[model samples]
Target chain A: MAKVATRVSYGEALVKYGVPNENVVVLDADLSKSTKTDTFKKVCPERFINMGIAEADMMCVAAGLATCGKIAFASTFAMFAAGRAFEQIRNSIGYPGLNVKIGATHAGISVGEDGASHQCLEDIALMRTIPGMVIINPADDREAQLAVKAAIEHQGPVYMRFGRLAVDDLYDDDYKFELGKGVMLRDGKDATIVATGLLVQEALKAAKILEDEGISARVINIHTIKPLDEEIITAAAKETGAIVTAEEHYIMGGLGSAVAEVVCKNAPCPVKIIGTEEFGQSGKPAELFEAYGLTAENIVKNVKEAIKLKK
Target chain B: MDAKRITELSIIANKVRKDALTGVYSAAAGHPGGSLSIADLLTYLYFEEMNIDPKNPTMEDRDRLVLSKGHTAPALYGVLAERGFFDPAEMKNLRKFGSFLQGHPVLGKIPGVDMSTGSLGQGVCVAGGMALAAKLDNKSYRVYSILGDGELEEGQVWEQAMFAPHYKLDNMTIFVDNNGLQIDGDITKVMNPTPIDKKFEAFGWHVIVIDAHNYNEIESAINEAKATKGKPTAVIMKSVKGKNVSFMENNPAWHGSAPNEEQYNQAISELDEIIKGLEAQL
Candidate 1:
């Protein structure tokens, strides 16, 4: 299948699922073309609002619309949406538990050419701190589309992270998406690779590499980072004895920390985290990922390292 | 409009001031200056202006008020109590743990509080969103938001100033309590947001200047706002930092400080005198 950016899938999903609902109002802060919210604007101009570079105002405006019974979708770059307008999201949306969906695009270092300032490595961490905030980071196009449907239906403050970089299709028509549930792709008894967002594809590739090397690796796609599927994570720790976590975000508070938190509490196991420890510089998306050690090779290395610690 | 009605509102406004001070004193911490400044406006809104039923605050199609200046929750809680949204006795639990009356206004926690606000600038933008929602549904329920002069320092406030007009939010009206004081000393000394009227006009709003404490002027400005078309209205009411309470008036020290036993008694007596005078007029 053709490679598609999750942001594009998000735009298409907004039209397919969001446009049909009259109460779904979409707001963008002058990044409609990049965020793909323009697709929703093109079809449903009446419900669309171009908020013009003010992410803070855009967030609170969505909260206000939600009060009047509208499912307001506010889209912007993750750096601006989750980083710049965090307090607005917390006080206006999270405090009241309003029905406002933040479609944060350009999350992680995959946002090529936009250096450290635009790349939002801390979005998951920032959004994670807010109470009752549902965080969704889909792995691919199909999951991104399905995630949008889930966000609109959940009826509370939801932060959906999407990427600017196009990723290959990971799931097909047979795939089912569930909120707060992790999908087990390839099961193994040696070690598990728990990954989210674009890294899930890398995890499956790493699992294949591990099998070639006579080492079994389980692959699990953890799309929902918050309200994490603790059962699956704890099961992976107990069944596999060790686990490796991969994501395009920081090592401190993304999927790695979330998985570790559950593992330490539920099932004691050695866990290795695969992500950037420092800020990202402007470069090609593939080059940045390679430079940051966010690759299939690195996941394989971490899986072996975690297995060693377990032994 | 009428003498008897004005006397009645003045008496109610005095009661709101007493109740607000009572809540602040009981809590031993809360904003009293801006709360007192906007007490008359809140009284006017809850009593004479807004299409709200304290009994049915969640009624669809009812007008909504977003207290964008959320530090003034004591005033909002006071007016809600006066309007019968809850028992007046509940004001004593202002910021105590497990109280519905949080430090800042929270929507679901407090009845008749249309939007949750505390961190400045967010509430005004939310109010604009509420106005847009009303226009989208063709609902006649108007949206009202009160902003502090100091709050204009927030860049987000200006963003909403631009948004309200760009979307043609005529159903919305904003009351700027130009009390000239923030947590810091003077707003101009801190950050000059002077020419407040010109700023709103430049942003495509029908600007109206009124004495915030005057019932007739508050009523007239709202009337003018309702009559205007294709744009929202900004009623910049020049007000004292603290009004009614003699010692608190114009004193930035009273901005967020809770009055002591002696001061609270004096404040209550001052409001009692005003209420007695208004009743004598009746």
Candidate 2:
């Protein structure tokens, strides 16, 4: 009778983790409130640094703090954090393999209203290409919390992608998330739908619709894009024979590219990728999703197409 | 430590310049102009000034040095090797495959190298970060970073300039090798970074302009930087692009180009005579 909400926004999860980890320091480049680092600032004013609008300087400062045994999380819009601070991350953090977490919010077309310039679609590709950088795109608030905690625990540089919009909370409070491990939400052998970030919920919904038609669909939430769970993905590909990947990013080097890399190397299976092929346009979140073909319906269509290729 | 000792260090810098030329000539490709320009400062820091032990390169309390203009690796490599951080014979492996002496400085590969820096403006920020870390940890270790004048064009350099003062990284000493020439041409024509002293002051740093090749001035600046409190110090060392080599001085072509055998011989002769003159004075 009522539409269900599945997850929390990335901002809420950041606050939950920041309150407990005293060693966790948050830095924002003048967008403290927008990036959700303001919550940490409220509780630990001394630990939070508003580094004006200098993202490059902020990244180096975070790397410095991390080198001194402090777990540092630098928060900024995806555009600034991934785009402006790329060199700093490459040399100072990635080169030395320092433990620094970059929380890049307002990723993809879901950043809506800000138009194309503000939204970042190629961040995952840029971050994942760097050696020793762990890329994580959490699906919702529960996963975002887990991702933040996991990033702190994981050594070396990590880039965590989150969205500006709030989504459904899929995980219960007691659920635990492991780095580089994919979670299978539904079990089926007919077709496999692998997805990440905000698209995981859509894949789950698509699985439900596929079941109504007497098709048993398997849905996996791939949170860790880099150091991908090859064993699990290869197993799923071998068992299902058909696979579809969806993400709120470009198909070139996002989750789809990662899945394709695994499938091409070890498990060759019929695969379909649903994501942005070109730059997103100025529109609402729903309009952008439909325009980019990142909807649950599109996932279902792509999954069926992949199933046809399997035969 | 004193005027006479600084003069002695200057003579040692000339020897370092000779070593740099030989190393680069052997490699057949390296930046010699900037390397010679920053030799005196590097020599004084490694030999006379900084409280460092080559045997314990990773000692937590030892002062840290970062060669931000890493293309001048020849100068740093020459000084570090001369200081016994590693075998002096290993200097021959510059830029060779699997050599610890990479085109740029890499940590752990070379002893006495505090950080790996090659991508221009990024190293200044890293050095600033290290200085900030020392302050946060309440360590007395200071950081010295040498940047090329041409690298001042990168915006990140200015970004670090704005941050260093806010945090009062007084223990950090930055040296700008104002060698006039970058890769293309003179820095003045390429990108004007005039009034450099005032710029550092504007960003809350204590500024000092000195003759870069002058051993006395360099040593004084180092002493002043260590004495000053509450703000980082930037020593704007006015230097010739190629200091000792007459034909290559102020020439941009020699920035990253190796000399012909004849030219290398000529450069060595001039350096050897200078070293002899200093020895005669002693």
Candidate 3:
């Protein structure tokens, strides 16, 4: 499959669902083009609202619309949606459990040259703190398209995390998007490489390299991190005996931490988290991935280290 | 609208103020100054202006009210109780554990509260959204919101000032409780949200200035807003911080602090005299 950013598919999928549903409305905080909400705007201009540069206002507006039975999708950069307007989301949307879908793009250090300020690595952590908040971090363009559709159907508040850079297209058209279930891409017996977002492609490549060395590595894609499918994750940990969690986020409280929280309680297995330990810097997407040890090489190295601990 | 109705509302507002003080005194922690300041307007809205039923609080097509300056929930609770949303006796449960009377106006917990608001400058934007929905659904329900003078210092309020007018939310009316004091001190010296009328006018709102405590002015301003067309209205009320109570009026120290036993008795005695005089007028 061709490579495309999840943000691009977000715009495309929104139009797919929004054009047919009269209740579906879109609100943007002045980043329509960047967040890809402009795609829905073109097809359903009447349902789309531009709230200027006010992210908090946009979120509250969405909450208000949701109270009236409108399925409102509010979009902005992850930094603005999850950080700048965090309290609005918590008090206005989360406190009420309104049906406001927060479409967050440009998350993680991979936002590239925009540097540390633009990158949003802690969005998932902040969103997870809210009770009953559904979080979906699609790994590829196809997954993103299905996620947008699922978010439209799902009730209550959901935060859909997307990124700026294009990565591998992992899922096909026939792949179904479940809310909290993880998709095991490859079956293995030695160790499990649980990954999310753009790093899922790197984990696949790492699994292949481990296969050459006769170490069978299982690769699992965690699309939904909040209502995390703990049963599947625990089964993988128990079967493989070793687990390595990778994500395009801060290691402290993201997918790595989420998986570790599940495994430690359920399986009590050896798990190594591969993510950003420090803040990101200015660099090309590829350069930043390599510099931050988020490449296939690093995933392969972490897999071997995890397997050794199991032995 | 008439002098007789104005006197009747004045009596109800005094009870509202007394209950507000009672709730704050019971909690031993609350914002009494702002509560008392907005009591008259709250009484007018709940008793005279807005189309709402306390028994059927979630009725569609009913007018909505968002208290943007949510720390003054004591005033809202008092009005809601007086309007039969809940028993007035429940006002004494304010800030108690497991009590529906939370420090702020929580949406589901309180029957008449339309939207949950505590963070300054957010409720107006939400009210703007509610007005927008009324347009989309072809409903005729109007939306009202009240903002503190100091709450204008929050940037989100201006963001709403821009949005409501841009959308031509004619069914929306915002009341700025310009009591001129915050928790810090005088709003002019504390943060300076002055030129309130001109700022709202600049934001494309139909601006109206009024004395918040005046029943005639409050009624006329709301009628003027309902009559105006093609734009939102901002009725900026020039008000006293702690309006009625002799010791609390214009005092910023009472902005968020609860009254002591003696202080509560004195405030209640002063408010009871106003109620007596208004009743004698009837």
Candidate 4:
């Protein structure tokens, strides 16, 4: 299978679908090349604004453009976009409910070599606290393109998370992407594996490993974490009775916390979460994933524990 | 501008000051000093300048203004009400629960507000974005913003100061209300953002200094800003902390404190006398 970074897909989609509408404008804080927003700038230089290494200014600028009927996409590293400029996003964009899309790339522990400062494990938590912010963590290349399209089509504030590392393509061309809806990949009766971002492929691999051990594990990809698909999560909990969640973020407030909130409210099930609990270190991407326990093996181990807890 | 027009604007400005004091007195907790400082400027923009319609506040090609120093929203609200953007009666409901007159300027709630702004340093950048939007769309409408002197302490303001000129946002003009006082004390005593004109000039803006209360100087500076090309203009207006109202003028205590009943009455009466004198001039 071909592997592509979600940031690459997002950049391609912005040029193909976003700028063609003429109302869509792109803003980057001098990280255009890394965030892949340079692709949009290459094609539409007039509509692209290089805000020059100021995250707070870029977010506010995007908010200002939104007020004037422009769909502005502000791109930067997740650490800066969500962590550094959190208040600007909350006050200027979220409070007013403006049509500003935050393209936060290089999220999570996958941002190896640069270590803890560059890897943003708290972006989901920071953005989730805002009143009307819609958070989408795409799983693969196809889903990333679709998430960008959905964000541009949506009428309010949207935060789209992308990855620095490439992962295998999990979906084909015919897949449909909808806001606030989860996609069920493989269904089973024993347990459910809920995942998001780069960990969705890990969840699928974990499901395969569990099946080899005679454990029928269901798989679900929850892209939207804010308006979480409680209906689907609740149904999965009721049918499977056990749930394991995987993500490339902190266990405290990422996909794990979101799924736990839904499961605890609607259906009482034993849910095990596979995510980092500490800051990541500088290493290879694979080594960082292993060190943080964000791998298919960890998801498989958690699934067994959840199944035992259910019994 | 002629004497008659200046007198008419002076009358309107006096009314705006009264309305701003009304909201502050009603709230019992709002920025009165800064609000009073910007009353004349607001009156001039909403009445004599900007091509805006009260009936259609969101009309395309309308010039937009962002109150970067948004704690002074009472003045903006008062000027908008005087311009017939909404009922003047709403001034009393400022900062009350469920009222459209919030403590700071909100965009959709108020008819004439171009952007929601309360956070210092953010509004100026947003105004730059609006100016960039006008250039991208090839529209003739210009963008305007007002900032407090102490607000220059915020680093985001410098970021925008660098941004507006780099992009050559010639369609934007910003006013720095150099009242010289902040919540702590005099701006120089607190944290010197002095040499403000020099800083803007260094940042590549067309810098112009004028007396904020002088209508002739204000109008001329605005004309200079519009005529200048290729760079944004910064009009540094030297002003009194509290322009009118005898006791509040240059008083740091009134920076964010509302007046008591007696103080409120005194302020309103002083403004009323000014309004009467301006009306007689007409």
Candidate 5:
């Protein structure tokens, strides 16, 4: 199957899900082409608002529309939406618990040659501090479609992060989307690789490599970071005795931090967080992922190291 | 236009000033300068302009108000209390523990507040959203928002300045309280966005200038906004930092201050005299 960017999938899903849902209104801050919200604009021009280059105003406007019972979605790059408009999201949308969905694309180091200026590594950290914010990071086109639909169905504020890179679909049309449930892709007992966003595919590949080496690894796709599936993560820790978390985000406060917070309390297990350690340099997505140690090779290496800590 | 109604609104505006001071004095903290500056504009909207019911503030077709300079919540809380959204007595619990009134305007906690606003440069843009929603839903309701002169420094204000006219939101009106003073001192010194009117014009807004304290002018400006059809309106009102109360008038230190017993007594007595004289005329 050919690969598709999650942002492109998101735009396609908006028209599919937004047509029947008449209350759906989309706002973009001068990045409709890049974020793929232009697809929504073409179909629903009356319901779409181009908020120009102002991300802060876009957030405030989204919050205001929500007050009037409109299911508002504001789209922008992660660096602008989650970073420039942090307080607007916190106070206007999250604090009020309004029905606003933030469609943030180009959210990680995979933004390629746009470099550290466009790459958003601290968005999860900034969004996590806001109260009542639901965080969703889709792993592939299939999950991205599910995440967009889920964000539309859920009531309160949701920040849905997508990527600049096109990824292969992991699930078929029958795959059900749940808000906080983790999907176990491949089962093993030696160790569990908890991954999110584009890193989920790498985890599955790492599991295959581990299988060839006579070692078993469990691969779990954790799309929602907040309201985490505590049951699945704890069970994985107890069953595998060691966990390795991977993401295309910063090492400090993305998926790794969220999983660590869950596993340490219920099941104390040795965990290795695989993520970008510093700002990204200008390069191709492949080179950047390799340089930042966010590859299947690294995940396989970490899985071996984690199995050693299974003691 | 009519002297009788002007007298009545004048009395109400003075009372609003006292109500705001009372809330601030009770809380021992708040932004009183900008609150006092925008009181008359707020009073005119609640009393004579807006299509709202204090009894049923959440009416679907009701007009919306967003105070973007949220530190001045004392003014909004005062106007809301006088408009019968809540008991005037509850406002004295202003910033006290367990009070429904937050330091800034919160939508659900208070009866009449349409949008939650505290950060500068956000409320006006939100007001644009409310107006756009009214257009989208094909409702006849309108939106009104007030911004402080000092708040013009925030970049988001210009963003919305570009937004409203591009969408051609004729149902919305923006009022900039050009009070000349900020906490640090004069607005020109802090960060001169002095060409406020020209900026709006360049951004495609129908611009109007008025004396904020003039009841007739305030009413006319809003009417003109309603009449203008293709774009949003921006009303820039020349105002004093602190409008009433002799000692606080034109003073920057009183931007957010509580009056002690003697000062409070003096301020109340002076406002009481003005209210009584206006009542006599009525």
Candidate 6:
């Protein structure tokens, strides 16, 4: 078995980039330690603002800072940043097309212990619906650091989703990351497994398992969900007749739905979406992943079904 | 300030009240009560106090005025039109489809609107951000935001109140239109935000309480705000829900309702009398 590389937490990645970017200001809604921006706060107190559970005010204030040419990153749990401050994000940041990076940590069922209230399963739908919003779900800590740097340079609203649990790194230290591009990790012909966030690692694992069984499975990392890499996805769909989408989000209006929208519009193909069909229950992260059908085993099963349907 | 000039501003305020009423009435929708109540404050800021260019609305160094209680956009539009930001003829397009004048203030659509604000409690925070930006840029531009007393019930307002003081945004001045009525009923019944002055003072702001309709006090309070430094100022302007118009005064029904023909005629007469008194003083 191939050894998996060590992964970095999104919080650690933010601190590494935040130290070099003086114009970068971080705002936390009393979840500094939880969201991992506390590392940045400790290093640069002047650039950090702990807004103490006021997500709406933080969103607006970030918009204000962005208007003044400062790259402001507002951090909170995905539920609060995406759900609580929905209107504030829509009007203050999205309406003005401000360069504000929203780091929504504890996304999806990975926020296991905190339960459904903290797990933001619907953030992608809410954020993607807003005009000019860039949605990014980094696969690992290395990708998250690159995503943060890229988002800071991007001149519009961007929502970077990160998980609470640690995952194996999918990319090398020197791997290049772009804003609106997808990366193909493996080549195959029978079926394609397109995934994002923590699911990227799962999809890669599933592809390896499928390769052993004499079935060729292609693995694609769709990090940037919005402004989706339709060309790559379309080409992959045409090359590999069937596609399976895996994500740590709800089946509706997330990575799966985004891919479906692109493929349905551009290239119609047999597709299967693997994600949570109901609200997540309280359990260990690994347990929840299995319970919610968000495992590589499930991806392998869904891909086989999709490949059968393709024939 | 000279008495004659103050009276001239009073006359302007009266005309603004008429314009606000007529705009709301013609549109068949708007917050006429609060708009009328805030006319003097808006008139005092735009015509007499603020250093803004009607031609260059987006000038970097121009003083910014945000209507936090943006439902009272008719009041702002009336004052901005009187200041020649746009033609007064456009005033008739209030709340109409495809008009620059929306139901609420939208920036860039209308000149002199610093921020698009329809959602209450957010405009003040945005203004605070603008004030902070001005300080950072080392510009002499001041930011003035007028909020509805009822809108103060929003928790975000207090969050911004705390933030403004922390930043020492003395370049910003916040006015609370204390008309005491919201859409449902009295502000106290809806959500009491009493002791508004102490609330600002507690938030580390320089508090000033005055009659919002009185032009002299309004002008003087704004002048006092300019002199004070190192902290933001909150002027709690005591105003009636609907000022001058007899049928609408303190009536919550008039909060968003336009006046009918007879009611509009009587309201115009009252405003005319107030304007004539100010003209005589001028």
Best by DockQ: 1
Candidate numbers sorted by lDDT from highest down? 1, 4, 3, 5, 6, 2
**Model 1 C-alpha lDDT versus the unseen true structure:** 0.94
- Name the best candidate (by TM-score): 1
What is candidate 2's lDDT per residue for A176-262, written digit by digit as tens?
A: 899999999888898899999889889998998888888888999999999899988898899999889998888888888889899
TM-score of 5: 0.98
Candidate 3 lDDT for residue B175: 96
Give the TM-score of each candidate. 0.99, 0.95, 0.98, 0.99, 0.98, 0.92
Clashes of each: 0, 4, 0, 0, 0, 0
lDDT of 4 by residue, A198-272 (tens): 888888988999899999999999999989999999999999999999989998988889899888899989999
Q: What is the lDDT of residue A18 in candidate 4?
A: 87
Residue-wise lDDT of candidate 6 within A50-168, one digit each (tens)? 77778888888787667566788999988999999999999878876888899998888988987888878999989989999999998876788888888878889999988888676
Q: Give the DockQ of candidate 5.
A: 0.80
Error of 3 at B26 (Å): 1.2
Q: Which candidate model has the greater TM-score, 1 or 4?
A: 1
User: In model 2, which residue pairs have backbone atoms overlapping below 3 Å?
Assistant: A6-A168, A6-A169, A7-A168, A7-A169
lDDT against the true structure, each candidate? 0.94, 0.84, 0.92, 0.93, 0.91, 0.86
Which tens-of-lDDT digit does each residue in B128-203 have in candidate 2?
A: 7778767766889888899999999988889889888887899999999998889999788998987788888998
True contacts kept of each: 0.92, 0.38, 0.67, 0.73, 0.76, 0.33
**TM-score, cand. 4:** 0.99
Distance from true position, residue A76, model 1, in Å? 0.7
DockQ of each: 0.93, 0.50, 0.75, 0.81, 0.80, 0.48
Which scores better on DockQ, 3 or 5?
Answer: 5
Give candidate 1 misplaced runs (Cα > 4 Å): none
Candidate 2 lDDT score at position A238: 94
Model 4 in CAPRI terms: which quality?
high
What does candidate 3's lDDT look like per residue over A50-113, in tens digits? 9999998999999888877899999999999999999999999999889999999999988999
Model 4: colliding residue pairs: none
lDDT of 5 by residue, A1-311 (tens): 96999999889989989867999999998899999999999989999999888899999999889999999999999999899999999989988899999999999999999899999998988898788899999988888988989999999999999999988988888999899999999999999999999999999999999999999999999999888899999999999999999999899988888889989999999899999888898899999999999999999999899888876
What does candidate 1's lDDT look like per residue over A146-201, in tens digits?
A: 99999989979999999999899999977789999999999999999999999999
i-RMS of candidate 1: 0.5
